[model samples]
Target chain A: MVNLGSIWQNLLASQAPLQSMTGNATTMAGLATYSLPQLPYAYNALEPYISAQIMELHHSKHHQTYVTNLNNALKVHVAAIASSDIPAQIAQQPAIKFNGGGHINHSLFWKNLAPAETPETNYSKAAPSLAAEIEKTWGSFDEFKKAFSAALLGIQGSGWGWLVKESTAEKGRLRIITTKDQDPVVGGEVPVFGVDMWEHAYYLQYLNGKAAYVENIWKVINWKTAEERFQGSREDAFADLKALL
Target chain B: MERDISDSRNQSANSLTLSLSLDKQAVTMSASLFRATPVARSALRAASAVKPAATFVRGKATLPDLQYDYGALEPYISSKIMELHHSKHHQTYVNGLNSALTTIAEAESKGDFTKAASVAPLLNFHGGGHLNHTLFWENLAPASREGGGSPDGALGKAITTEFGSFESFVKQMNAALAGIQGSGWAWLAKDKAANGKLALITRANQDPVTGNYVPLLGIDAWEHAYYLQYENRKAEYFEAIWNVINWKTVAKRFEA
Candidate 1:
């Protein structure tokens, strides 16, 4: 396992007096930077549900922009911290949250999807424990799906819909939640799975038929990942990000 | 601490003096303030230091009144959509812009550059939304009046030379509108750098057209613009909007 804290210390050490004084926010050689994760399945794997064109652009164009922007913002943040520029640090916060959330959300979103008709896409076969928990909460698997779909369609603008496992007194309880504009699920909630509701997610193939997109997304949902996130700790669910570290 | 206190005093005094001046001047002053980059703004601040209590007028943006009724463009654009789009969405942007500007001014006075800079995205988003919607209202009229049909003057001749014909221009504009990946606007703009040649462009989210182009006609491609009326068939909304294009306004902008 990689030492995440040490990696951050190294990042700070590299941005010493010389680099900080120059205000050169560009990534230096040998510097650790956040990068776009490779998709588990081929771009065309989810075809007939999500088109290959939509997958390619969503991953390459949209997600890559988020990763690039997050790196740039983090560099500026590091420089600001070195200078003790409170205002500059505050200014970099929004970009960090927005781009950082975009990266985290897209990274998780890709892992939680599978090729249509696969065993991983079948809740009954791949996610028995999660299916049982969901059925217990919403009364049935179909009811949970209906409720989740309603939450997805309710988003006014750009956002995401998530199924999360509660970590409060109601530990391990299943819940459906929605967040606006690239906001990730926060606090102690384990994001079992999420669906991107940004127009770019479905606009190419679905056009303005958002309901159809919502309906079709289930066919590609990776229930195996959902079950794993449901059963594991938050650290286990976020292990993919740690791999990048 | 002494400098911060003096700065606040000067800012208040400037505000008081601005209140006594003409409203038009106040609007112009605020517009210029919003346009300046952080570096240019600090330079402006340094320049103003010589005259400690000079004019630093901050103005609030108000919603522009529509010449036609909310339901004027109905059947094509529903009264419900127009009312929500204008009263709810556009008004939110106007309020946000005013609040962001106020926050920046207050922050700058207190030497809180962090707060000032943090409000920059709100200023950009709401500012662009306010300006885009202001232009969009004027770009429409009831089909019964001076709406739809091709231009007949120099603007008409230019359209023919640039995009082949009026029909082709409409087709191309619709194509641009349909191609937008997310919430954005598709515009028919005059490319200032290329000697005012007509061009079709798209801006993602509420980003306004800047640099070398003067936007002449813009079609709102955000789902909010047509989702309630046309639903999934946004291609219909794109096609239907041409019936109320207000070509006279486009021609006036072209000539200007």
Candidate 2:
């Protein structure tokens, strides 16, 4: 019997969109060179929770460095190839990996947050479906937040805590996973949302207070964007499985 | 340039056909050359890409020379930390590895396989520690002039291709390194089996990246590496170390 599902997947994948510049590293490099993604809101947008100063430096200074470095590395890589020096070319992997990951992660981090609702509240404003999913997964929204915060603080050095959907599974399930340094996970699952735990993400105002940053970030989470990400993941789950298979 | 583009397009077409050939042939679905998600197609391309091995020579263990002064990586990694780490910590591993090797050689001469097996753990721990540190030192440069630069050439493209952008790669490395509990090392490794697929991996203690994975760079996550300068503030230490990374050495390793 012809596996129509597989055929559809192969056909779709071959013609699959660049996924735009949604911050996937591998795809970004292929579609020309990567550029720094602009923040959706102003630097002071997530004030009280995330400071304007932190946002400005993170976006302009740190993130820009990654973009600049990545371009430089690519140039060196091109020259290395031209010279036929394979070793020299491969040695540039770390620079590309580090800066590339930084760009990809920060690009997503900017969109993960938004200006908190007025009157200052501590509550989960996730979309209805996402709220329901969180409740189903952890019994309650607060429970999910608590677990997520704990995991975020438990990071020993620098890294990220993610709320990702395992799209390749038989069923799409949300899980909290952490990656060290600038490593980004793609291909296996679709990332619904991610938080950068690197000190640069919060060290300026939060100082050593990772717990505060983790707890407060919830106030500014872009629930609409998250819901969109969730919907996209669900649609792509089958395609992901086909690719993996 | 147009010719190169056409050549690459042809190469990609050939590879895609080869990939379909390897997959379960329930049906032959031929599609236009334009089809395929860039990321997903890259994964398929990886399956058929050339895998290169990083050559390493096993010889007498000795102290590796630092290209810059001990104080070179200062502020990020203090001179105190560098001096102690290299002279004391790494030296201990080198000595231990050499000693273990001597015992193993003696055992082999005596045909005492059991004796050789007994000291195998020591050899791996110390030998891996030695090798890992060797790569670690080479990967670092003085933040002053020599270090803290972006990657270039093939190394840069590999990072962009494998991880997306240099920043994304850094974020992954930082996150993975921070999450590592106890003493361990975080690696930016090239998977030779999957056509030099660059990936971030972590190994506890002194475990080496053996088998099909070749390590391009390693960040030491042990407290001793930064405790003197950053105290319990591991984040600061991790953040600062980036300012001193020797991307050139890393690039060279990748090209190798």
lDDT of 2 at A129: 70
Residue-wise C-alpha lDDT for candidate 2, range A1-104, written one tens digit per residue = 11213222212322352221122323223323445666878899889889897788778877887778766775675566456565675666666666656666
Off by over 4 Å in 2: A1-31, A81-84, A118-126, A234-245, B1-256
Candidate 2 similarity to native, TM-score: 0.45
Name the best candidate (by TM-score): 1
Every model's DockQ: 0.06, 0.02
Error of 1 at A214 (Å): 16
lDDT value, residue B42 of candidate 1: 57
Cα lDDT of candidate 1 equals 0.75
For candidate 1, the TM-score is: 0.53
Worst 10 residues of 2 chain A by lDDT: A1-10
lDDT of each candidate versus the true structure: 0.75, 0.65
Q: Write down the lDDT that model 2 would get.
A: 0.65
Cα RMSD (Å) per model? 14.9, 19.8
